[model samples]
Target: MTKPPPTTRPVITPSRVVAGVCLVLPFVAMLWVGSYARVTPALLGIPFFYWYQMAWVIVSAGLTSTAYLLVRREERARKGDGR
Candidate 1:
């Protein structure tokens, strides 16, 4: 019987490290910023303490998207997408 061919999965690369950092840093920043702003006053009409957390909703989305894109690119490259 013929043996199955060996898989050619791409090894972990620098992009993976970047993606991991992108995923983790924003979350850590969000936590620290939220805590630091906890006792601050309002800005314009919005509360200072509230804005950081609220802004993180958008920032988190951006960070997540960046991470996803990086991971997808890495996967595609691994699959020999000619990157």
Candidate 2:
């Protein structure tokens, strides 16, 4: 017997894209070792390597929160609860 055809998938939206970027930025920043693997820029005497990661800690939180809020709003609107 033949297999069934696939169903339609959800289309990507701006909100979802923003959320994806929010989640990916932190990983990219941390993984790009050559970018921050240095001691030239120091934060209160902390090496660039260490300080860069620390800054990302805060940046990640903000990005994550923004993404959460954006997607959440979209979901709520879809559910007819955009108040």
Candidate 3:
């Protein structure tokens, strides 16, 4: 019985760390920004605090996407997909 080839997997990598950080940043930001203080602004008759959270919706999406992409790329590289 012949043993199968061992898989080339990374125990840790830079991309993985970056991706993980990216994923956590928005949540931290949301918590800090939301409960830290209060702001009053009249943008289209909307309050500053309200708009701040709303704006983070987009920012969070972007950060999550970036994290996803970085992790994916690292995974691909680890798998040796023609890198």
Candidate 4:
């Protein structure tokens, strides 16, 4: 009897692309320091540099969660489990 071929490669889909973008956005925003490296436009006396990073802490959480959910949903669908 012949053995079945192994499924070694991952499939790339639109949902996966969106999830990847969602996950990468936070890193890009934080790493590009020049964009947020400033002291003007203070918020409640807080410097822009400080406030921008702090705000990203919250935004990053939301974006990461979204990416996780998207991947999880795609996996579940692939497994034929609607729930």
Candidate 5:
């Protein structure tokens, strides 16, 4: 009988690490509010703390999208479809 092809396990790559960082940065930023809790370096008169959180809204979206793309690309590559 012919042997079946080996199944490959998913492994962490640089892209995956970047994806992880992208996914985690927003959470860390928000959770550590004390770092941005200030009035200086305000943007257009908005307080630093408030503006920082709001900025993360857009940043988070980008980061999420980036992470998603990175993982998806890696998955595709693993599936032998990256070319």
Candidate 6:
């Protein structure tokens, strides 16, 4: 009996790498507490620590959206579905 062909693995292209970075950056920034563990740099009376996290909420959304788009585009290209 002939052996079955091996399953194809997903290619790790540059666009995928950028998507991964986008997804990971927010977690890295938030987890690195020491970076924003301050009170001086206030934004409209909000402390740096608080404001920084709040700002990341918006940034994270954009980054996540970008990552999603990149991955989707890559997948479409792989499937030869240029849309």
TM-scores for all candidates: the values are: 0.70, 0.83, 0.72, 0.88, 0.78, 0.88
Better-scoring candidate (lDDT), 4 or 6: 6
Model 6: per-residue Cα lDDT over 5-38, one tens digit each:
8887777899999999999999999999999999
State the displacement of the C-alpha of residue 64, model 4, in Å, after optimal TM-score superposition: 0.4
Kindly report which residue pairs in candidate 2 clash with one another: none
* Candidate 5, pairs of clashing residues: none
lDDT against the true structure, per candidate, is 0.78, 0.89, 0.80, 0.92, 0.89, 0.93
Greater lDDT among 4 and 5 belongs to 4
lDDT of candidate model 3 versus the reference: 0.80
The candidate 2 region of ten consecutive residues with least summed lDDT is 74-83
Write model 1 residue lDDT over 1-83, tens digit each, in one string: 99998787656788888888888987688668547565457766787777867777898888889989999977787679653
Candidate 2 residue-wise lDDT, 5-70, digit = tens: 878678589999989999999999899899999997788899888888888999999999999999
Among these predictions, the greatest lDDT belongs to 6
* CA shift of 79, model 3, Å: 0.9
Q: Which candidate is the best by TM-score?
A: 6
State the weakest 10-residue window (summed lDDT) of model 4: 74-83
Model 3 poorest 10 in a row by lDDT: 33-42
On residues 10-38, what C-alpha lDDT tens digit does candidate 4 reach at each position?
Answer: 88999899999998999999999999999
Those runs of model 2 whose alpha carbons end farther than 4 Å from true positions after fitting are 1-8, 81-83
What lDDT score is found at residue 6 in candidate 1? 77
Q: What is the lDDT, from 0 to 100, of the residue 82 in candidate 6?
A: 38
Model 2 residue 16 lDDT score: 98
